[model samples]
Target chain A: MYKKPSSRRIKKFYAPLNLIPILDSVFILIFYLLMSAQFVKIFEIGSDLPIMADSPPSNMKDALNLTVDVDQDEIRIFTTVNETLYKTIPLNSDGTFDLTTLTGILATLKGRYPKENAIVIRPSSLIKYDDLVKILDSVREKGSGKSSIDLFAQIIFGNLGG
Target chain B: MGLRFRGRRQKKQEFYLELNSLMDVLFILLVFLIKNYSANNLNIPENIVLPHSVASKQINQAIVIQLTSEKKLYLNDILVADLEKDKELADGNIITALYDKMVDAKQNIKYKAKTLGDIHGTDEIVNLLMDKNLPYKYIRKIMFTSQTAGFKEFKFIVEGKE
Candidate 1:
C-alpha cells in the first residue's frame, strides 16, 4: 500500500505457482501405472518332454498321450500316437473357452487314466496368447469354491507341439 | 508497518495442502513397482504378452527360447529364426539353423551334468518363453529342434498370479 507507482513496481507483483495441475497429472499417471502393473508374479509351467534322450513309448497301448490343440474357435483334445479325438471344448460367445468345463473333463481323465501324467497343449496360430495360458491353467488346476485339486501336474509337449 | 501487516494477512489467507499422505502413497507405489519389475524381463519383448496363471512353479536356469507373436524366435536373447519363413527343412522337421544353434549349446553343457553334479538338472532342459497365443506348430518345430539338439525336457515361463 505504501509502494510508489514506479516502472519497477511490475517486479513486485509475484505470480503464485500453480503446481496443482502438474501434481494432478502426475498422480493420475502414477495411479494408471499402479493399476496396470502386475505385482509378485511370473511362474513356470513345465511340460514333460515326450522326446527325452531315452524317450520310450508307453507300454499301455490302449492309453495314449494327450494332446490339446486350439484354433480360432474351439479347443480340441486328442491322443497324439493314434491321433484319436477325445474331447472338444468350444469357445464362449465372447471368444473364450469354458475353462470350468475343460477343468472338469481333465479331472475325469485323471481319475480314469491315473498313470498317464503328461498332457500336451498346442494352441493354433490364430489364437491370442492370453487365452492359451488360461487353458493351461485349467489343465493344471481344478476344483473351485473351497477346495483345490491339482490335475495332470506332469504336462509335456507332444513330439511336435505344433 | 501497515504494508507488512497486509502481506502477512495475504499469507494467512492462502490455503496450504498436506502433502505427507500423498508422498506416502506415492512412495508405496514406487516401491511396489521396483519390487516386481523383474518379472517383466523374461526375455519377452515389450509388445509381447504372456498368460497369467496361479498354477506356476519357480523358473530354473537353462537355455531360454522366446517366441513372440510376430513369430520371432529368440534363443537366449539372440534372434535365431523367424518361424514365419523357416517352417521346414529338407533334413528334418526343425529349422536347420535352430537345430544347429541348439546342438552347439547342447554340446557345451550336456557333459556338464556329469562334471558339475547337475546343480540345476539343466543338462537336459530347455526353458521355453513362448507367447501364449503362438500356434502349436511353432512350439512343435522348436521342440523338434531342441530334441535334435539333445534337450529332453522343457519348462514354459508363464506370468504368475497369486
Candidate 2:
C-alpha cells in the first residue's frame, strides 16, 4: 500500500467547439439587416380639415386664428381676428420664399398670443408641396435648439375660398 | 536533425486563426444594429419624392394615401383614381373613387380592431405621402375626399432633414 506512485501523467482531452456555422449565420443576419435597414428618416406634419364656418367658434373668438395664404409669388399672413392683415412677404429674387421674414412675423405673433395654437394654411393651386412645407416649417417654429419657440402647432388645411 | 524536424512540424500545426476578438466585434455590431432597427413598414415609392422638413414628429400607424407627381392617386398603394382621366368624376372637390376606397379601408380597419382586440379604435386618421412637386389642388382634392370618407385627422408624411 505504501509503494511509490506511478510516474506516468494523465492527459486531459478537450474538444474545440466549431464556430464556422455560427459565423456563417451571423454574417447572413447582418447582411439581411443591412439590406432592410431604413436609411432615410420619415416624419409627419399633422393638420386638420377646414372648418365649414367662416369664423372660429365662440370659445376661440378671443384666440388669434392665424391664417397663412401661400401664393406663387407671395405669402400673405393674416388673422381671423377682425380679418386683420399682419404682413405680406414676397418671394426672394432667386424665386424662393422669404421664410426668415415669415418666421420673424410668426414669432412676434406668438409672443403676442401665447395661448393661441391654431393656424390655417391656405396654399394656392400654383404653389408646390415643397414650398408649402417650407412655409409650414417656418410657421411651426422660430429659432433652433433650446432657444426655439413653438408657433402655431395646430395646423388646419384650408381651401382658397374657405 | 530529428528534434529540428519535430519543431518545424509543431510550428506548421500551430498556424491557426484567433477568432475570439472577431466574434466579440461582430456581437457588438449585431447588438447595435438590433437596437437601432426601426419597425416602420411604410414603403415609400421611388417616384414619390417627399418634401424635406424640420418637423420631428414620428409617423404613426394610419391609412396611407399617396399622390405622385404624375397626378396618380393611390390609397394604401392601390391605385384608386387617376386625377388626369377622372377629372369629371370629382364631385366638386372630392374624388369619388378615392372616397369609396377610403370608406372601404375604414370599414376594414374597424373590423380588424373588433376581431383582433386592438384598442386604438376608429381614430379616423390618414397619412398622406405626396410628391414635393405636386400642386396644392391635388392635395386639396385628396383632403376633401378623405374628409368626406370620415377621416378627421390628417398627417402629411415627409422626409426628415435638419
Candidate 3:
C-alpha cells in the first residue's frame, strides 16, 4: 500500500523572487538623471546712478572722449590730454547736442591720434536718464557706415559736480 | 518524481494556486505607480542651484552681451564693444555695427518666415549677460538699441555663487 503525506505539510519548492532585474533598472534610472543634470552660470547688472570706484587713476593712454561742463545749466563735449580740456560743445535741452563745429574738432583729433580708444562723456548728475540715453544714442548713430570705427570704446560718463 | 498514475491524478485535481488575484493587485499597483511617477520625482536635477532674483531665464548657448560698471562692453566675451574716450558712453560706430548685425538677424528671420512660423520670435530673444558690478545705464542702452533694432525679448544671464 502506498503511504500518503499529512494534509498539514507545506511545500518548500516555491519560486524565489528575482531582485537583480529590479536593481538593474534602478541603477539605469540613476545614471540617466546624473547625465542630464546641466550646469549653468548667471551674471547681473543694475540701473541706479553710478559712482566711480577708482581713486587716483592715471590718465588714459588712448585718446579720450570727454564731456565738458561749462556751468551748472549746460554740458559741453571735448577730449582730454593729461588733465587739460579742449574743443567743447554745449548740449541742447533735448540732450541732442549741437557740436557747434566740435565735430570738425573731433575729426581733427581723430586724425591726430587715429589709434586712441578712450572717449569720455561727462554729464552732470542732474541730467535725466532719458537725456543720457538720447545722448548715447546720438553718439552711437554718428558712426554708421563710412568709417569702420563709429565711436570710442572706453567711455568715462561722469560729472565733476557729482 | 511521482509515478505516472499519481501525476495524472494531481493534474486532474483542479489546481487553485490563486495567482490570478495576486497578479490583478500587482497590475493595479503598477498602473498607479506609472501614473504618479512623473509628479513624484522627475525633471528636477540633483544639484539645484538658484540664480539671483533678477537673473534672466535659462537658455542654451546664447549670444552674450556683457557690460561693466565703468561702461565696458563685451559681446560674447569678445571685445566687440568699447567705451569712447572723453565720452561717458559707448562708441557710436560699435552701436551701428551691432544695429547692422541685428538688422541682418531680422532679415534672416523674414527670409525664413515662409518655412518657419515663428522666425521673428526665435530671433527676438537674446541673452543679455551683465556683470554683477555693471551699471544699469549700459544695460538700459543695450535694451533700447536692441528694441529699436527689433529684438524685443531678452534673457538675462546670471552666475549664481551658491
What are the models' TM-scores?
A: 0.63, 0.84, 0.35
Instruction: Kindly report which residue stretches of model 1 are placed more than 4 angstroms away from their true locations once superposed.
Output: A1-40, A51-71, A77-86, A112-116, A120-128, A143-146, A159-162, B1-42, B84-92, B111-121
- Judged by TM-score relative to the true structure, which candidate is superior, 1 or 3? 1
lDDT of 2 by residue, B73-156 (tens): 888899887787776854367778888888999988988898887765354999999999988888887888888888988899
Interface RMSD of each: 6.5, 2.4, 12.6
Candidate 3 i-RMS? 12.6
DockQ-based CAPRI category assigned to the predicted complex of candidate 1? acceptable
Off by over 4 Å in 3: A1-29, A35-162, B1-51, B54-79, B82-89, B109-113, B116-121, B158-162
Tens digit per residue, CA lDDT, model 3, B43-81: 212222223432222353334455544445555454554
User: Which of 2 and 3 is ahead in TM-score?
Assistant: 2
lDDT of 1 at A149: 76
lDDT of 1 by residue, A4-85 (tens): 7777556675556555676676678677667667554667877666544566556747665787777778878887478689
In model 2, the clashing pairs are none
lDDT of 2 by residue, A7-98 (tens): 54445545566777888888898887787888888999998766578764786567677888888899898886676888899999999999
Give lDDT: candidate 1, residue B55. 59
Runs in model 2 deviating more than 4 A are A1-25, A50-61, A145-147, A160-162, B1-16, B119-123
Model 2: residue A88 alpha-carbon error in angstroms: 1.4
Native contact recovery (fnat) for each candidate is: 0.67, 0.79, 0.14
- lDDT at B85 for candidate 2? 76
